[model samples]
Target: MTRSLHSTDRLPASARAGHWNAVIAEAYFPLDLTFRDAARFEGQLEHSNVGDISLSRLCTEAVQYERHRHHISSATEEQYLITIPRKSPVDFRQLGREVRCDPGGFILERGDEPYRFSYANANDLCVLKIAKPVLATKLRNPDRYCALVFNGREGIGSLFTTMAQQIQRHASSDPNSDAVLSRHLVELLALALDRTSEVEQGAGSSVRDAHRRRAENVILRDLSNPDLSPEIIADAVGISKRYLHELFAEVNCTVSQFVREERLKAARDLLQMPNPGQMSDIAYRFGFSDQAQFSRLFKAKFGQTPSGYRAQITAACND
Candidate 1:
């Protein structure tokens, strides 16, 4: 379904700010809007839901939007915004880092944090509001991509930007199709971000980052192998075992821990399928030695056992 809000509609000038504030909050989240001229402010927004993601196109006059700590206190879930400016540059500051995203670039903003985003000129923007957990499944440490400008004019970034516009232009009315489209968009986004040189550009040397990326790919590919370990990954990537361990340590996790977490995430994805299969089979497929251990670890990480999680999803779908 599609919905829209216009500031110029029959609403009174004095009521425009309050009404627009409510519309912005309802479409995205609570935000403090400071219009260059509140009484003469002009803006328009159209929003639609794509599965668990919210997509919106906003056009507005000069304005500054602020998400303060108090506004975050009322948020029921943690969300991130991927903003793409179409007509002018956008200035965003978050996590002590600031960036200016040009028309051919995009930036990620953390909704749970305090940030100031503004544009001095009239601007048109494409914004995606997605929950953190939903994005985490596709990319590890999604927050690392925040507050950085990404090229949307070439490479995978261009593909992602094109897809987003296409989805907005031809949004499916069928809920199931919309859900699938949302998943594809997020997967593409993860690929675009992961392939970028900026992914770990600030972490260390480019050579070390390249090796780490290779190691991660090896782990993801051979996740079904019960013996997947630091030694095996190191050998597969032509790096020493100690070097592999050191690489992972730079990210504050051991190789074994990364493997286990990936397995759990894969298993959870399976459980969400229409036919997830028997618990034992699902666990074994992910290289879990036994269903009991899988259950314990899954619960510890996701706050629910496999069966419980599936049941909850089932109940929600039914409703």
Candidate 2:
């Protein structure tokens, strides 16, 4: 279902307080609100559901909101609320930390905890609610994925920003595709959380180590090209092909093997898209020259043929 709300009119002078109270109760907090000059309050909430995820786009003219909390009826279910601000700014507090979110900034809050969010004048926000168990099953450590901020301008954050925009566009164009898009969006979120956790735990390698970082970056950049031979990549990076082999050897894999694995991962991502074509087309697009060769390699890596994997994703999306 798709829902949108936009309003520009004021409520009756006598009923202004009640009108604002009702709107807040229905959309955000189910708690009491005390306000001054309620005659100035005006807002709208645009929301939509895509499978298990609920998205709400909100905007407010002027209002002072109080701190509030809500309890979930299901004891076993955990909830995560993520807010992405699109316009103006919002001040948020969670887990003993305070954050100011502007456009392209996001904040995560746990449902079981009480928090305060204050939005200033003329603010636009997008809120996404996700179930904890759903994310726990995908992440390495679920408890660590709280109160994180993602700046949508660099690294994995940039990738996630692109994915979110794509999903939103697709949801608007083909509502029926929501189920699949939502699932992928969750996975993307999970991956982002995991990457962030790694950075926080000091698990990521030091980028200041120029040699290792540059070599890794070069391999990643050319991993999709069918002609991504180690010799060619080494030449492009001004390194000997033998050195390239030695670098990957430290990771217990050959350069060629890594390239193949990367290509297969790329192919899998493409197959998951809602494309109207044969599986062979997906294989070819990912640098596979021969369909049968691609099938053999993909099946070996994933234990399923391209067609079989596509069918499974389609069925899951429909369900």
What are the models' TM-scores? 0.63, 0.53
Candidate 2: 10-residue stretch with minimal lDDT: 200-209
Candidate 2 vs. truth: CA RMSD? 22.2
**Best by the lDDT measure:** 1
lDDT of 1 by residue, 1-319 (tens): 4545455567779988998899898888999999999888878887888887888889899999999867876778889999989999999986556788999888888887678999999999988889999999999877667777888999889988888877876767788898888999999888888875744447324556787899999999988999887878977886556557877887899999999999999999988889899999988999999999999999999999999999998998899
lDDT of 1 at 70: 73
Residue 118 CA displacement from its true place in model 1, Å: 0.3
* Candidate 2 lDDT, 1-319, residue by residue in tens: 4655545365566676777566655554443454445666666666666777777766776455544333332235557777777777777664345567777767667665445677656777777777877777778655444555667556666666666655544445465677777778788777776666456433212321343456667767865567767767766655445445655665688877877887898788878889737777766766787899999999999999988899999999999
Judged by lDDT against the true structure, how good is candidate 2? 0.65
Q: In candidate 1, what residue range of length 10 has the lowest lDDT sum? A: 198-207
Rate residue 178 of model 1 by lDDT. 89
